[model samples]
Target: MDFDTIRNHYGILIVLSTFISRIIFNGFCWSYGTVIVQLKKQHLNISDTELSLIGSIGQSFGGLLAPLILFLARRYGYQLTFICSLLTCVISLFISSLIHNLHWLLITYSLPYGFANAAIFILGTLICGHYYPVNQHIKHISIMCIISTGFPIGYHIMSAWVFSSIEKNEWQIMKRHLAFIELIATCILGPIFTMKYSSNIPLEYQRPSITVTQNNNNRKSRFSLPIIVWLIGIFTTMSAVNNFLLHLESYLKYLGFASARADLWFRLHGLFDALFRLSIPLFIHLYPVNIIYLFPTCVFTGFIFLLLVFGLLYTSINALAILPIVLFSFTSAVTTSLQYTVSNQLFDKDETEQGYIYHVIITSLGLILGPIIGGSFLDLTGNYKSIMLISLMFLLISFISFSLTILLSNKKEDTHQSEQN
Candidate 1:
């Protein structure tokens, strides 16, 4: 193929490679849930709490390492960062298969693998920045949303398929397969991603505009009001979702819903979440939204439906509660799925990597704090409604933060336009 033809298709190739990377990352990360079932059945002696530590530790370390991951990626460049991290993930998974002991597996299997996932994931965003010029990054968000859906796809579908029909005694085999799948996927995309970073690129390929470069020079402007507010918005949004999902089944049981019915909606939430993420490019195509405003609009809409669901629960109108739940699920899905895109718009094109790194770091807090706060409220008040209230509280805060982001982002845009004129 000619250079222009390869250049023309390079963006799609990058999206596809990143998409596959996301699938492998989440597929392996969440495989622990399925792995736990077999583990519990086999060990019989291990407490659920102890078994739970495996996934939790992995996720915690995975998320907490974002800053360091950024440091390395920036220092070593994407080519080395992606390859080394991918290898680390594959090797960790392979080593995990050899150890049957839960304690060692906690350290051996999940921790390094999770860190590698974070490195690959963070670097993926940075590398994609190279392909799409800074001005066009907003458009990049569309494909990125398509890519983001890979998480749910992995969580809901890939993990199950990996374990499907495997004997209870064969989980070691499952880990090996997970390693192989990731390794193979990396190999397939290695050439494409290799061309994406570090070597053959022009020096002036991705320099930021003078205005944005000026803004970046000031650390305070880098963390300007709008961006800080958006950070707050993301934190609350994630906390609310995690808080709600962590206890949804229990809350339904407390409200007298059948176990089977609750399971259906709970699973439906994930299914619908993925579907909505898939629909994002179409939604953008039809609506032509300015993501600056759309981001807040979505969070607000979701907050409204979520509140309606809570109201239905309190009014003894539980029959219609699931309706709002489904609607909330849609908005929740869109907001979370488009978050990375929205974050891209929050900063100058050249500064997006730092913005994204901060975005991931803040999100990890929501993940940890959400469940803890929800569980605490439930335990303290002996009321499941308390959990709902906490979720609502965070959701509302997220909406407000996003709205403020809209106002501040617009103000910054207006200022820049005025200065140019």
Candidate 2:
């Protein structure tokens, strides 16, 4: 738990390995909308709803498989789980590139590939959580979030340089190229995960040991009314954000921007997302503010900004779309980091696995619903404005839920202190 320990050689290696692995895994996952859009234009006869369903189904399946992956990680170790995930990803991407039929593509990319994505992401989070001490968890997690921005960074750069330059017919080759890159990344970082230093030490060394009575109290508090409200907030926030992200490019296109321009806007969104994530750790350190309060504040502010921008766009001021992009990026970064750090704060060290499992399940529900709902709006109205409104409603629900949770948690704390007196 010492500061010096966190700055040691192995610590640096763990950070570097996690950075590379996350970039490879998330880069492809986030880039799916662009790929799907291209596929719909060229080869697929599917409607917007159906295409969105692909990602939803894939994510839902991945969530369903998380417990099994977690089990394997416990029994066989993270190294094997990571290796299998990487191989599955590579094979799935390769198969996706070669497949001519939509159903086969879904079978390969949406099912096994989705499972691989979740396994890799969850494993990375668990690994990083284990590698750092409790005191350093937020800082390290923020660093991981910064590293994860590489997904969008790589996606944007590649779209601008590689995908845009290629003929429209050759867009599928991007998937094959991604497969090759993942193979190389796995080959390089996979060995680092197998190193003995990557294993998690017992919680006693990581944090102060809790007595039985305190443990019981912590367990009770972990699932109390406030925590349930917070979980609901997290679920709604994730769904709202994913709905925006999944359809942002398509929305831009609908707004009359060219495909290339839309891609650039997407990249711009990534840039701001990374910046906000990088800034959060510093912000938390400088201010004596509670993240539970800060999180919902950001969500509410972003939601309001999005509503204003959407209103402006509806009035034919299309150029102001950049405002919502920036707001959404910042809010998404805050919520994403808080979701991990808050879970850490709420649960006992030994119970984090269970806490994270619940987190994943809730997050997966959002992932599954976001796109389906957004796409359904698109189908129903044949317009992007309605979808934007729906996303705003989701964010509003999240903001209210989180605000109530914070208030109830404060009330509970007050009651506990009164009892002690």
Candidate 3:
């Protein structure tokens, strides 16, 4: 695994291409919350809970389909898998744009579109991992995060320019336009994957050993109970974030901000999110802190900030919303990046893929639940404050669970050392 050769051959082109593809994919998937808000305003018959269910169904279905997509990637290669997925997305979006019935929209948007987006994301991640050197995996993951800052950036762009420009009742027109843009982008970028260099370089290039270990018992199964507990923490924390993102715009509207103004705040939140992710690699390069310590600290801090946001909402203080948004965005950004890095640290290469699958499944559960719970709270209370309170509780539980994981890990290390003595 010659690092220089791989770097020279592919350079940044691969990263840029994948970034563009992800931006296109996430731009639509993540921005659907804003679209849903618009849709609800125009189609007064559909309840918030129903709309949230549609979004949840898409995310949960995507999770359910991830293993199959991974298998397809393994069998047919990422290029072909991506092409097929993108085609499905294009068709799904087109169909969704024409739908007036909520049930029909659910079938087209929630199932095929969501599945394709998840497939593209997972395959893109695996492809990126394959291309980079073993030693540079963290750097690779960070860069991918930095590129994924595009997710929020894309949201901001769409919210500020595209969604804001449209008439309140013409949300479907916007969906149709988005479908056209996605169709063109897919056609142009899908073929790039067909090139020979697009395939993974080779398995031999992977690192010979794990870089991080919890104890002398390196033979421990990646699926051990401790790891499972840690994953539960991950799942809970991700659910909190997903819930926050889904409801943030609507919450702002509930707070009485105009749609355009609410979107501006959303865009600002994304800017901070991008900054946090982009700074992670540089922070590691400079500090070289132990991730085990750093990861939990970030999680706990974000939850605390979330508590503050809840307090602010309770007080009806609109001017200081930015503070919590920045805090939450920073926490969300770190969690998203570290989930990959920590997974790599915890598992052997052979087991990493399985770990990712489990992570996605757990995350999908959170994604599914976040909306339903939030929507239910909204429907029952006619406000988002209760949702915030629930999210705070979720984060608190995750913090305790992760803290226990660290403690148990240390206990295992102590036992391992005593046994050797």
Candidate 4:
């Protein structure tokens, strides 16, 4: 089919593409924590600390290697790269099911799985940017976000079932069962969703800069160390926020709230996440286009939320515990939408997709650090306050880093325009 045919049926095609990919991405998001527990259980020698280290290793590698994968997607079509990534994850998960040895598990299963997760992140963003109209960029991203919520949502539900099965059956058997189920799901759905549209061009046609010429590729050299540092710091802050949100239940209980009541607060957190995902675009239309100012405002508000959560330990507000948690959810939603939107503004059309891959990898690494460090602080001091403090520091750093990114971005833009003159 020609571009016109696909464009004529754009609505249906975009929806299908977004839905399947988002479902797959969110499934892995949920699987991240699930695998941590399973890996620990399967390996007798791996302590909680070691498990954390393993996760960190996977995260770091994924962040660093994501650019290369994005480069590949820029060569092959996005659709093909996405299918390959889904298949790769299924294969890794299957191998993980069979591997009893720790060394083999880490080398083959865990590391690859982590890398595959990075691939999915790249694929999802690129696919969205490639297939949808550029003018509708934020709308498409928000639509994906709407679909992406299914990832965490499905993860929670499916993991519950998996855990129940794990309790009843041997670990190996449970692993095999889940693996086959995932494999079948990917094998059937991956091909169907990917091949549906024939007009999809090779990555070369889509993004020729990477291989266009040596000089052209030079323009795409990696960011400077200082910039990389800034990106990493922003990622670390986002990671801390992710950790606090994920562990809000334990944080509340530590602050003297009842387990049931604390759990209720967490459910509300999920509700706000879904609501924010749905609502951000609506709000985005009304917001000023001052990406510079608006982006920092999100950082500031999110930072304040982090502080409130941390302060709760000392103040222990029984009447208003729910408010900060709600703010946390809102902040995550807004920050997430803004992150993509700001990233969209920062890079050109050709550069935006790959930049997104880099961003996700960095952000995922931050996520890895957040929980590991948060858990350590809790285990060492028997308090959640330290975690909150760490989160606050990370967010402050993010606020600064984002400010620098904008400054650097604007300076670069001005320099380019002057040279053109």
lDDT of each: 0.69, 0.73, 0.72, 0.60
Candidate 2 C-alpha error for residue 348, in Å: 3.1
Tell me the tens digit of each residue's lDDT in model 1 across 61-161.
56677878766665666667788888888899899889868779877876787678767776676666566544564466666666676666655565545
Output the better candidate (1/2) by TM-score. 2
Cα TM-score per model: 0.77, 0.89, 0.89, 0.76
Alpha-carbon runs more than 4 Å astray in model 2: 1-7, 58-61, 141-144, 158-162, 165-169, 198-222
Total colliding residue pairs, candidate 2: 0
Stretches of candidate 3 exceeding 4 Å from the true structure: 1-7, 198-220, 314-316
lDDT of 3 by residue, 246-333 (tens): 7888887887878877777777887788788888878877888767666577779888888887777657575686788777887667
Instruction: For candidate 4, give the lDDT of residue 305.
Output: 72
Worst 10 residues of 1 by lDDT: 197-206
- Expressed as tens digits, the lDDT of each residue in 197-287 for candidate 2 is 6445422222356688976786786788877888888788878877887787788777778887777777788777777777777787777
Q: Model 4, 1-421: lDDT tens per residue?
A: 8766775376455456555554544444443444555555566565444455455544344556776786776666566776776776677767776766766766765577667766765565555455553467566655656655554444444445555666578655765676677677666655544424534443453435455575355355446543574576568666766667545554565567764465456556655666766776666667635544555666778888767655654664555756776777665665554455455555555455555666776777776777677767766775667667777877788778777766776787799999999
